[model samples]
Target: MKVSCLIFFLFFSLFAVAQTTPTPKKKLVVVNSYTQYRAAIKSNPNNELVEIKKAIPGISLDIRYATKNNFMQQVMYKQARAFARKPVVESLKKIQKELNKKGYGLKIFDGYRPYAITVEFYKKASDKNFVANPAKGSKHNRGCAVDLTLINLKTGKELEMPTPYDSFSAAAAAKYEKVSPEAKKNRNFLISIMAKYRMNVLENEWWHYDFADWKNYDLMDIPFEKL
Candidate 1:
């Protein structure tokens, strides 16, 4: 009887220890060195980050993170520039041409975010669903994601969207049905056009798109200044 109690106590102690022990975090490889980025470009020219505005003529930029108007309510980026991988930028250039023919233009909001900025976003973001977790990294950190909206080429006015950039509301969803007809039309048009060029919309974000080949690139911590 005493031996049985001892075994039971030992088993209970072992179970308690197992329950208290934290699971080990998965290791993430983030390329933080400028030289490493350069070497990557050398190995695969497609890995090069290309400035969107420079690659696409007449592209408009309203980098919200550069100003205090973003969801953060604080300036998150020093420069108001946008970038993407070589193929991604090439696709954007083609998309701009296609949009221009229809009297529309592309307005860039954010692109090629540094991994460090993603960590900051995860830390301060009130709604965890809207921000990328630093542990997994963001496609923006890989230069394979873009936040943009459509605009009238002639008047340079933004088309109506379901919700404003980074709204973090259910209405911000790409397929949300509660928005106005005009907003839904514009949102679907933007998604369709981007999709045609290998950029697919985030299900919860009307203005955000992820390049189909985003996994080809590594998460990078290289800042805009370094790039």
Candidate 2:
């Protein structure tokens, strides 16, 4: 009968539509297991994460995530330590030497963040623009980004920058022009020196820098304790 034929066609069409619907694709690949991380380093020594302070002695650390001073206003990291990929730390060593000679030193606020922490930041951040989405892991999770500032070698006082570290305001923009001459000069100087060592500043954060070869690294979720 015509009625039976119509019902069968409708059922067929619905089945076709269901079959053609695509499954959502995973947007990120994170190395979450220590065994996996160890395998990665074994395959490529460059993947090894190096502790920054041990590699560059005298490097200052004010790890905010380990305290309640960061934008989250909650302690996110258990340890106040910083690490980066082998080559990244090497570049920091060179940058530190260069800055130290000029009566300045690098003060690290963060480096090589765990991917899970980045996800937590995205979930809790009031200003989403300032936080990396969990769908796309952060460069810091790849052990190829650093959050830092310049400090006077003698006084250990941080230099005047356009905005403080992890500032979610417009003034934190790397190229924001509406700042004091001293702030602008110091900001640009920091950018230039970091560039010379293959570390480029993030457009929206004056203190955040991504190593040039970041794409070569894998997003990681290993904790500082494991490293």
Candidate 3:
């Protein structure tokens, strides 16, 4: 009878432990976003991409940024990635889902850039005294702007567009390449998807889009890990 009681106590203790100890949390893994663009060797090493499966629980890294042109593989503002807030990530995921249904994906150019990176960009812009107004507000800083084009997932090829991203010339004009049927189709398609979300093009740069409510977001420098 004493032996039976001992076994029963042991069983109850085990059950209590199972009930009290917390389950192991699902882990999220992500590579730093700026690490690749800063290298800019022209070889887009895919290792740096944020994996959705390893990121937030129940959320997968949406691979909308992958493109085909090989030439369109431009990375921008290494320090600018806005993983600081959950709303920002959710917004991008939603856009990814919508674009996927349209047979295209969002090719990310830049996101969540540090203010210091913006300082570097501003200096090069020949204006703003090398200090971003902190008011004009870069899209990446606001976690809303993304430089991308229509990418066909099946072929893993970016649809022909007006010009390469971040090209500082007339070639970058949205309607400049009107002669190429493929370019026009690609350009129009990009604009259409952005419009659905009330996003607007940067005008000079065809590939850049900014969400209309950008003012609501504050400039943040949260590291990618904290996201």
Question: Model 2: runs farther than 4 Å from truth?
Answer: 1-27
Error of 3 at 203 (Å): 0.7
- The full ranking of all candidates by lDDT, starting with the best, is 2, 1, 3
Name the candidate, 1 or 3, with the larger TM-score value.
1
Tell me which of candidates 2 and 3 scores higher on TM-score: 2
Report the lDDT tens digits of candidate 2 across residue range 1-227: 99999999999999999999998897678999999999988999999999999999889999999999988999999999999999999999999999989999999999999999998999999999999988888999999999999999999999999888888899999889999999999999999999999999999999999999999999999999998
List the candidate 1 regions with Cα displacement exceeding 4 Å: 1-26
TM-score between model 2 and native: 0.89
Runs in model 3 deviating more than 4 A are: 1-91, 125-135, 177-179
Model 3 gets an lDDT of 0.54
- lDDT measured at residue 33 in model 3 versus the true structure, 0 to 100: 48
Q: Model 1 residue 47 lDDT? A: 92
Pairs clashing in candidate 2?
A: none
